[model samples]
Target: MNESELIARYFAPLAGPAGLGLIDDAACLIPPPGCDLVLTADALVAGRHFFAEDPPDAIAAKTLGVNLSDLAAKGAEPLGYLLSLALPPDWTERFLDEFSRGLGEAAAAAGVALLGGDTVATSGPLTLSITALGAVPHGAMIRRSGARAGDLIYVTGTIGDAALGLSLRRREIAGGALPAWAKTLDAAELIDRYLRPRPRLALTPALRACARAAMDVSDGLIGDVRALMRASGVAAQLDLARLPLSAPARAALAADPALLESVVTGGDDYEIVCAVAPERAALFEQLADAAGVAVTRIGAAAAQESVLGPDGAARRFARDRFSHV
Candidate 1:
């Protein structure tokens, strides 16, 4: 039998409140009175999410971060999580130690305890899965379907830094010329961002109030926002000039104008994309200020079924940001 089938037969039935019923990433759990349960899971496989040579600690951290990002999108506070892990038989002890360190650091950052998990040997490749559970107030969970046509769209942190970071790492591995953004950044920073991204749980409480809709930017900014628009039955218009580009991203764009496409369409940015009402702009600004986070108003929603750019014309995205198929 295949691995998936074996898991279904033996592992799935064994899951309960003590174990998730294999319905989703992590377990759909319960919390105290007035609390809402939130669950999310993510998996990373060698040759898929990371290169074999990538640091194990970074890999473990990223696996957790991706799951945490999903919980943040729902405006949930990190409660605890389960780790289902497998490592190749040949993986080094040093690698495992670093990997555990990274994972431990990320969990602590979210204020979550590592409740329980399973570890196994694997001949295929190093793989890690994290199922994060969180709690929010009853009826307070943010979703992707509440945006109105006139709502304004905002993104937290910056838009394109992580994508640009990935490009720099790939160039270095291929022995190609470094991108200008790479030149300005410490090489380690770029590589680490590509691997160990920070989850936006801190922004969730603020967003729970102002945001009409929200989603984490696992896919590219454009594609993720598009999902929000689709869910809310609205169209969006973005002022290209308003995108939150990092200083290094601007430098890269100045050096090689063609790289703008990557900045827009590349995925794996863990920032939050959310919509707020036009009147709530000031309130959002205040909330973000109190939280010491910046929320950029990049665009607004329109009834028309298109996204317009700076010149007030529709811009066609070059590619779909993330797709399982």
Candidate 2:
């Protein structure tokens, strides 16, 4: 099918009212009264972001879910999104069908609707990009620069699952060397964490009410935490032992403790990390619990410009996190 027919058949039903049935050249969006709009964009390209053989549905979810993650960190409620797709010559109609089905499901789950977008042919690889829009009460949007010295640092859910999952998918980890528990771990669960990340939208209200500063962990924890610190003009002291790990990850680490470095420094974790004042930490945890998201306090901010380790000593990593550069 051609581009127009492709959208009309597979994507039009996903459009919101503001999408104008995706017939117009542009979409129209209006924020609620006394609220400010929040916007974020993310892109995924095959071979670079996902394996070439990954499912189209998963690719669609990741493309949109990553953008939703940004809104969650900013304490915004999602409204709608625009998608742009670049199709490789080898792409089939079946691929588009599954891709749109997954995209539609993700949009519904996030309480957002499709706006409008573009599709084009590409000679390189399949590429998907999404620009998500959300809203927050006026002047209430959380920021990465609001963290203060002495504020406690917290992360939602566990970390490093996606990173390790990617390693497994890429065959970088020797499956035979893993512990029995690790070997028995369901491959689908680990890989699903990598492919279909659950954005912490449920925690947005709590973050708006309690977090001093927040950002989603797209890059590795170590690098993203440092980014937060630098943005807030503060340093942090993290306890490596305190970094939350999933059971599979824990089992893998038990087999090889050195995997801790990979766990801490790898990326693609869509969890949220935030700074909260020491006094407000308890309330924040309570609110997050009510939202059904598990949180853990891993460190605190300081006036220095360094990240310390569990030994209360400053340490350096050969590579802190993933960099597109």
TM-score of each: 0.86, 0.94
Give the Cα-based TM-score of candidate 2 against the true structure: 0.94
Maximum-lDDT candidate = 2
Question: What lDDT does the true structure give each of the candidates?
Answer: 0.77, 0.87
Over 4 Å off, model 2: 172-182, 305-315
Candidate 1: C-alpha lDDT: 0.77
Q: Which model scores highest in TM-score?
A: 2
Alpha-carbon error at 188 in model 1, in Å? Answer: 4.2
lDDT of 1 by residue, 180-215 (tens): 546765555556667777777778867887888999
Q: Write the per-residue lDDT of candidate 2 for residues 1-325, one digit (tens) a residue.
A: 7777888998999999999999999998877999999999998889888887778898898999999999999999999999998889899989989999999999999999999999999998998889999999999999999999999999999998998788777663333453343586665567788988899999998898899899999989999999998899998778766778888887777776667777788889999999999889889999999999999998899987565554566667889888855
Candidate 2: pairs in clash: none
